[model samples]
Target: MMNFTNQISTATDPAKIVDELAQGKAEDYNIGFLFVSGLSNTAMAEVIALLRKRLKVDHLLGCTCAGIIGSEAEIERLPASTLILGKLPGVKILPFSLNQTQFDDFQQVDDWLQFFNVFPNENPKFLILPDPFLFDMHEFLSGLNQVYPGCPVIGGLASGAMQPRENLLFINNESFEEGIVGVALVGNFSVSTIVSQGCRPIGQSYIVTRAENNIIYTLAGRPFIQVLEEVLQKATARDRLLAQEAIFLGIAMDEYTHNFKRGDFLIRTVIALDQSTGAGVITDYAKAGQTVQFHVRDAETATEDLNELLLSHRKKEQNKKPLGALVFSCNGRGENLFREKNHDISIIQKCVGPVPAAGFFCAGEIGPVGGSNFLHGFTNSIALFYPEEETAA
Candidate 1:
């Protein structure tokens, strides 16, 4: 069995926030997940030190963020919050910290497995928080894919720091300015992942006929610009306006599927277009012979996308409630994109039925898309935790 509780305090005083968090937490918890935001720069260390002494969990991991989400509120830039999950009776939680130098040491799958003392059959899930400025998560995640295959790794990149070594990452009681902090959970639970890029498919899907590196020159044997013109002509006035502000291209991650929808594609930003050359540049590499579609993003589309995904997942769960959830949303979302307070967390509460949830605004969110994990911006990555008995049913 698993027990979880989340606490959020608006107090600017670090000690006061800690006091509120420790008020009624059980003493038998094996692990604690903590997130802090809006506290003064001078108070980060003190707050962390106090939580370590007060919470007294066997293992603790978390990081500072631009904002913190706890309960049903998306508290941005003015609150300190912590979510604690009590002891899992049959679980093994191992907390680890790594820098760029240390990540380079584990060069092989056997090396990783041996280091973590985990076999491939253990099916562990990772909760990680890395500084976006220092670590190359793309390379790290790619390696993990080779080693762990389908293991779920969920968390967000630390936010609120302007430059290198400015962000705070925590493992146990220690804090670091440059590195990653996380834990490996190797027993008695499962985490279901939801990664919403928050965009809606706008135009019909097209097959790429010609492309050079990251540039797409032709789609369905026509110039890429021609395809864009045709799409814009058919789009609604509202969609056209959204396209002008933020248009993206979704490359089909699985070409085997005959029908493509919103979640079927790996969305990439349309960075630039050349009218004369009839070519386009995207943030992600596009290869010839891949299926692609245009997508438009706005507040309305984002809300619909999240609500649909959450509802679909709940339907598939057959009415079993999740124990808790960890949400990693891009800093660009929340009030900045939604223009409303408590947007993402509020939706989760309504759709996922008010399970205890905690998270932070990330510089880049991490979760799987198309059966592979990628670092994403402007995406909301959620991990829903459930016990063995819950999922077995």
Candidate 2:
């Protein structure tokens, strides 16, 4: 049997929030933890006092983020908090945190693996939460891959405007700005991830007829700069405005093409556009013949993207659909980023039915891409949990 429970609270006191969640927890939970954060700095002692006082568990782990999300509201927006208690038998759980100085000393992740020397559990799926201030996210991902090739990594940068100088990050009990805190689940328990990019491209797909390192110089045998101008020239004044606001590039995953369904595109952010040469720089390293398209994100695109993810999930041939979903979306994507409040939270519940779900708006997101997962930004990744019998196909 698989089950989870979630709670959302507006009480500023950690203890108050914990009491509410303890009531919601299901009886079957074996191992679980609570992830908490808000605009205020609630010390570990205070957070622990609350957890120990209210909930029972073999072990617990968590960190602070820029904000918290449970239900439809943000904790920072009010005195809000979110919690999820899980039930998983025969599972391995390992938790760790790292600092900037540690990252500097270690050229490769090989250096850090020594810190987690035990390899406590085999075939572990890692859930990472870096102190946004201390860790170079790119290096952190690379290091994990080096040590545990093919391991699934999830979670996001600790949220907040908390920058290097401001210093606001929380892990377990300690607080700092420069390190990351994470929990790695190994053995017995299985993890299945769900990603809701919340976007649908409208532009026609085109081939990257030419390109240089990280920069695109041509498309469909046309000058990269020229094609871009043509797209803008053809756009309506409104589309032109939205394009300037949040334009992205979609690189259709070749893997998706094989599905014989809709085209699959792994979206990438377009970091820059050179008016002088009509070229663009993208987060994805482009290659020849790869399908590329101009994609725009707005309230509509996000709505469509989410519906697609949920629909696809329901359509899966699995014996069971998702019992619960962990929704980690971009901080820029919630009510603050959309035209409406609670849009994502509502869509999810409507489609999946309210199974216990918990997560916060993140600085960046983490999930899969073309069979390999990467930490993503401005995207929504949902890890849907189903019965082990479903995965046994």
Candidate 3:
């Protein structure tokens, strides 16, 4: 059996917050996660020590963030902390941490396997927390994808720090400011991921005919700028207005899948465009023969995107309901983008039925899209835990 519980406290004092979190039926939680907001490094350390001593969790992984998301509320820019405790009867939890220097030393799949002390055949799922300033997110994610193919990596970049070493990452009883901390769950569990990029596809899809690295020179043999202008001219008045600052590019993740639609493309931000040359630069690499489309984002689109994905997950997992969830929402979201509080979490509970969930506003959210993991922004990366049934001998 798998059991999970989540608790949140907004008290200013660390001891009181810990006390509030500890007020519940006692169970030996084998793994735990903590997300803290508006707490100093010293105070967060105290909370970690207290939780470890009180809960006796065997493996704990967490980080500090600009906001904390609990089961019932989303607390932003306040002194808040949320903890998730889980008891799994048949699971192996392995915790590990790596610094920039150690990560740079890793060159092969064997290095990653040795570092985690697990084999690729084990098929473990990872929850990682890395300081946004010091960690090379692209390199780390790419390595994990190569090493553990099809394994889900879910978590977020630590937030609420103005510079390097300001954000805190916790593993077991210790905390650090300049490395990545994570845990590998190896057995008797399943994780379902929902990555909502919060953008609506606009304009027709076009094949990339000319591109170099992250720059798109042509689409369907026409200059990229000309295609974008034609799309805008054909778009609705509201969509054209939104394209001014909210435009993005979505690349089809699977080239073989035909009739692509929403949820079929991996969205990337359009950073700049060369008006004279009709070229555009996006955040991710683009190559010739990839399918591409323009996208737009707004409060309505974000809400719709998240709701649709959650509903789809609910429909797919009708037989085995999730026991718990960890939500890594982009810091750019929340009330700032939604114009209302508790937008994402509320929608989730409404659709998924209030399973124990805890996480934080992240600098960047991490999850898999189309079988490959990538770091994303203005996105909500969620991991839902489900218990696997026993197989016959």
Candidate 4:
């Protein structure tokens, strides 16, 4: 079994931050994680070079992001960079790149595993940094589910670019423009995923009685519009006002669950309403017989939901602390949604007691919900790392 050691940084001066971190006692470290905002694009080449020289790790993975998260702060729309250095004793890390052509040629898990020299029994966890522009993420995630069942693929889509091929991904000291760059961690570690979609259910759960593709015509034997109207009428004044723009629909991924709680549902945006037919349009496919509920998102609910989830994780783990965390938050969060600046990361630190963490504001986040991975918007997907076999001590 191996112990975990890490350090996190958010500094404006790339060279100075790298220099400070390079001075740390990191001789046993095998992996380096980095995320930076576009403000440092002018000097990214130098940044990567310095990281490679200083970290001296077997794997170096990162990307340019809309914002950088580190320690207890989420730095948004600013020039910032975050780095996490880890010493994974007995862990095997394999880094790879995927492009449009490789996606087509990709057929089986063996094709991916051979490059990493890993077997399915190794139980690898993936850290994905995908370019939202070129990758058909839905299809890619679906394929991974079928090929590598029960493995956690956690990460965020690279943001900070408005158009295709504008974002950058880093593997080792090299940078790429149009592909996915990620690493597979196999052996002697445990990874737990926490995906907070940032919504709480407003009304009782209902079964989708009628639906077509992404449109929901009815719920629990009534028109969708009628159900929504009832929910709205019952909502408090503040919730009603928030419902006007911030309302969402939570599709229960496990329909059999008797009580659908906060994390049980996969939250999707309520895009539009068809008054003529009393149907509701959702961002994802809605099928008959699935459980559904209306959800609302405001600063208060978002804050409470995040805090509750983090506290629950703490209770489950009891006295054991996590080594670090990687947070993939939505671009819609931050001051745009909360009145405060360090809202999400601050709450995480409050519950977990300030673990070494780093991440970015993603255009779309990727994590498992109801035992499967999906591309989600307006979510805070976090992965907590644990040392190997801690109970034996």
Query: How far is each candidate from the true structure, as Cα RMSD in Å?
Result: 2.0, 3.6, 2.1, 2.6
Clash counts per candidate, in order, are: 0, 7, 0, 0
On TM-score, the leading prediction is 3
Cα lDDT computed for each candidate against the true fold: 0.83, 0.65, 0.89, 0.82
Ranking by lDDT: 3, 1, 4, 2
Alpha carbon lDDT at 223, candidate 3:
97
What is the C-alpha lDDT profile of model 1 across 208-279, one tens digit per residue?
998988899999999998899899999999989998897899988898888877579888898999999999
Better of 2 and 3 by lDDT: 3
Tens digit per residue, CA lDDT, model 4, 1-393: 333344445565778767765666557568777887855455776778877876667788888889888866788888777777777777778888888788887777777666556665677888899998977888888887776677788999998788887788889867888789998888777887888888888878999999999999999889899999999999889889889986799989888899778789999998999999999999998899999889998878888888988898888888577787888999998888897888888888888866888889999999998878889998899988888644210
Question: Considering summed lDDT, which 10 consecutive residues are worst modelled in model 3?
Answer: 384-393
TM-score of each: 0.95, 0.84, 0.97, 0.92
Residues 1-393 of candidate 3 have per-residue lDDT tens digits of 797899999997889988998888377888889889999988988988887778867888898899999998999988899999998778998899989899999988888989999887888898899899877889999999998988889999999797999998989867788889999888877888999999998889999999999999999999999999999999999999999976899999988887876678899999999988799999999999999899999989999999999898888777456898999999999999998999999998998966899999999999998888999999999998888833110
Task: Give the residue spans of candidate 4 off by over 4 A.
Answer: 1-14, 40-42, 108-117, 389-393
Write down the RMSD of candidate 2 (Cα, Å): 3.6
In model 1, which range of ten residues has the least summed lDDT? 384-393
